[model samples]
Target: MSNTGSASFLRELNPNRVEATKREALLENPGFGRVFTDHMVTIRYSEGRGWYDAKVVAHGPFSFDPATLVLHYAQEIFEGMKAYRLPDGGAALFRPDANARRFRNSAERLAMPALPEPLFVDSVRELVRVDREWIPRTDGSALYLRPFMIATEAVLGMKPSPDYLYCVVATPVGSYFKGGASAVTLWVSENFTRAAPGGTGDAKCGGNYAASLAAQAEAIREGCDQVVFLDAVERRWVEELGGMNVFFVFADGSIQTPPLTGTILPGITRASLITLARDLGLTVREEPYAIDQWQADAQRGKLVEAFACGTAAVVTPIGKVKGRTHEFTIGDGNLGLVTARLKSALLDIQNGRAPDHYGWLDRLF
Candidate 1:
């Protein structure tokens, strides 16, 4: 067998496990990204040695030098996925292979070495297995897994690191929205642009998210839940929110989303919902949507619903939109039928409450 085989990786476990009582208590109210599981997975990569030292160890802080390459040049990438406690009390992952592939893409874009897909998936699987007890049992809740890679080389140059660390840590999370599943209002950010052509917007890197924080803070200060950014070139086309992809449902029963044109992040949730919508017999369109057209359509009742989708939020309805000069409400500013139906369908499949006709779930236990 290969040295880095799944069995070898599994045998390297040294779990500093969390106490059952404390873990259970945290699971009871595990807010998003706050509480973590007992164990984490780590693998090291070097220019000559390749990937080595794979292990599942206790979750804790890492020793980082002040001049670490990632801190200076930001050579890092990450993927967000979840492990669900099924209705039958088993554990499963939702399209982890997809995440593995995307992680490779992000690594390539950021000038980082791509960890083998099998290794990536196996690392996540073993960590989730060791931390299975941390999976939250609350409804609309799961163990949110974050797999990230960072350049660990202690250099302050403008080049990629020669050494890297890939790690996976999981946190049991409750509903992403604090109070409940209510519609949200969005603030259009005409002043800031998320990404331009031939940029890192499509890559799932920390820099892109860091660039969006100022705009997101602006939205929060302006009495909005999220900020919607436009395309960088024209500044008129609707792109996406800070961390999620936007979808619009028209009055004619057609669903539209901004195309993945190297400027917007290709969201896994957005892609899944597109397939699910088509399977439900709804027309799915991938085209550029303009901010002004969104305002006009919502005002004229042509746009029935608008929602954002991501790994964290899943499907969130956009009720009210506020721009500098234009403002409108979509479909009575409530959760539209299409939005609710799509959300329920995706969640059902994810939680294993519905039949796995599409074979999306990877049964881990």
Candidate 2:
């Protein structure tokens, strides 16, 4: 399976597919990642063979051996992106090349084989093409794509596995956060940290999310919608949410976000927002923001709006923040002007409502 080069995937379509009626019923309210398409893309990788045996096959479970390396050592990586529905019933992918580059970077960080970026993009394109019908017809609805790689060698070792299995699966999704465009409350975790300076925090891997479940549960217990982690070193600087990057909007029309200083996952949506913000002639700064400062500014009306961004969540406004003994609400405790404007701009480009000046859409149909 070690070919490291671009290879066309063989087609093995699903025969016992779901009828359009049932699929349509499911798509009507596919909350998120619940209803999947019929087929998935899979590619095999070996130590010396690189990547091979690429194909689109029926979506189902794999019989994992008891001694699978991924089960033991947890050497795995993944990427998340979406194929949006176009005006003419076509579908377009947003910044797939960026997702591909990030996938390669995540694989390298996990000590796994570097899957060729072209192959990664191709796998996603092929999967969406095969499951185009799975894409929702609504403007904001989409077919969420998950491309992942895991060490498949059946060995009881602590080193990197020689065999890997790469697969791409599609799910019809509406909104990531149930709150939708409404502002969300965040619970600051004083007891836990998400990522450190020299950690896998920047990589799109399962381990990071696995480590965040406890804090997320704690947030839910504290009556919050999401968990925001602080810097691992001093625990004073704001890092990011469990799965999204955050941005702060000031009353002076300036925007700031925690810098990508090797501790935060560089989100594709985050980058796009920065570009769009700059295009709007608003000053954008990548700097460290402390929790105390956030509360103080919000209380004094210096900070007007804040939002979290990611491939899944897109741009979600942050209205309230709650820590151990402190809580403050952003401007009016509602969706701020800047937040709504940016979200509309981003969704417009994604759903083909506005001109894609940045050339971000990769048309799939």
lDDT of 2 by residue, 1-365 (tens): 32555678899999988899999999999999888899999998888777889999999999889999999888999999999998888889999999999998999899998888888888899999988888899756888999999999898989999999999999999889886788899999999899888999999999999999999999999999999999999999999999999999999999999999888999999999999999999999999999999999999989999999998898999989998967999998788888889999999999999999999999988
Candidate 2 deviant stretches above 4 angstroms: 1-4
List lDDT for all candidates, in order. Answer: 0.90, 0.91
lDDT of 1 by residue, 20-74 (tens): 8988888899888988877788888889778888888878899999999998888
Q: How far is candidate 2 from the true structure (C-alpha RMSD, Å)?
A: 1.1
Model 1 lDDT-worst window of ten: 1-10
What TM-score, over all chains together, does every model reach? 0.97, 0.98
Please name the candidate that would achieve the greatest lDDT relative to the true structure: 2
